[model samples]
Target: MKKFVIFSVVFLSLILAPILFTILSPVILFSKDNVIREFEKNFNTRLPKSTVSEKIYDDYGGFHNDGMKLYKFVFTAEGKKSFVSYIQKQKSWKNLPLSQAYQALIYGGEVKDFSGNITGFGGFAKEVGLPKISKGFWKAIGDRSVVTARFIDYENLDTKTLINLKSFDFYLAIYDTEKGVLYMLKVNT
Candidate 1:
């Protein structure tokens, strides 16, 4: 009986530990202030005295119990609109104006290896929905002259059960206000 109890305890620990760790890791690692600080540190070039314009929690989808907090920043640079965000669950930092740095992490294929099963584009597309993500979606997103980006949670696609939508992978959108161009970044996560 003692041996059986010990084995069960060990098995439970092995299985549940990671699950628990994944869920709780974000709370332990990052706080709202930490995210704010990281954003300031990364985007300080444009935003010398980064001020938090807004802070709000948004549900990207129904994937995880904890949602993401979006941070908006108003930079001091002329003709430059920018912001920064952090995904608590993913523990990632993203600075805006959607530069190459942001692309590298979101769609550059590096995020997949870093976060494992947690993907940037996949989470984005799922949350934004398919109708809003058509071919010309990029143009529309860019027309706004205001660029907002965030790493919020969203639903995961069940590839095994569906085949027609198999081509669908991940979603990312960036709009250049001055250039009047919208850029879409997609990757297989």
Candidate 2:
């Protein structure tokens, strides 16, 4: 009886251990380093040593949880070509001028009067744990910019419609062509 019980326990352990690891691997392995690698793999571009990255927020480690990741990469001319090629293949990207990009992203398509008082109020930064980047930073960006997004609850990237969503999964990528810089953000809530 002892022998049978011991064998049964060992067999169960062998089967269950792998299952447990499979479920827990993401929680255990998700880190800044892994995020960088995932970025390179997903974008099919290598980030140079000078690339600046920050984990603006993280609540739960796994993909299913609420968290945010932000990356800024400055690429050489050659690197830019490779990245652009990859981006061009992607569908549903919107090319926006600097001003519109700022309005849509920072202000969540809020309307402002000439005096610059916000007539409409909705923003993604505060909702997704992103810090308020200075308007000067947006102003300094070159004229040509591209924005693309995916959200769980939001059907489309329309600014006004998205304004009222309290919490949802969000992924946004902005590429500044003139500066060869790319900013990628992912928020899951």
Candidate 3:
């Protein structure tokens, strides 16, 4: 019986090895390049070919959460049309841009690895045992602009299943009478 059980365990391990590797492969090969590629793939769909009006400045780190990195971007752009369209698509995003900064953390569309989750990044948090996140902010750069935000959440897709999503990603949209630009941030916890 002992020998039979040992054989069974080894057989099960052999059978499951590839499956486990498939699931873990993303992490072993994790890189910012992958995250950026994945992000652009998803983002371009929402704001296709929105051109940048000014130079973009990016800041990244593991400061906010241990074992998790966060990315923050500050820039100017001419994506008003696309940004407004996205705001319209979001349920929690407010209609008035100057009145208030709106926010939500739902699972959003169809994530590559997570199947067809509809709720956006916030819902993903619920699935992985964290409080839902709300990441929007009032205008810091320009008082006239309303700084809106979305949690990209996909920044850490490689580790999405293993880590918390709420602390890992965010996108902020800031707009005023002159122009608009989206601030994209990614993090992990």
Clashes of each: 1, 0, 12
Q: Which stretches of candidate 1 lie over 4 Å from their true place?
A: 26-30, 43-189
The parts of candidate 3 lying over 4 Å away from their true place are 1-37, 40-45, 53-78, 92-179
**lDDT tens digits by residue: candidate 2, 29-49:** 875567667666544446654
The model with the greatest lDDT is 2
Full-model lDDT, candidate 1: 0.35
For model 2, the superposed segments whose C-alpha errors exceed 4 Å read 1-28, 31-33, 40-64, 98-105, 108-119, 125-155
* Residue 3, model 3: Cα distance from true site in angstroms: 62
lDDT of 3 by residue, 37-82 (tens): 4444534434435333221333334453323122222222445555
Instruction: Report residue 71 deviation for candidate 3 (angstroms).
Output: 6.1
lDDT for 135 (candidate 2): 23
Q: Sort every candidate by lDDT, greatest first.
A: 2, 3, 1
**Worst 10-residue stretch by lDDT in candidate 2?**
136-145
Winner on lDDT (1 vs 2): 2
TM-score-wise, the better of 1 and 3 is 3
lDDT of each: 0.35, 0.53, 0.37
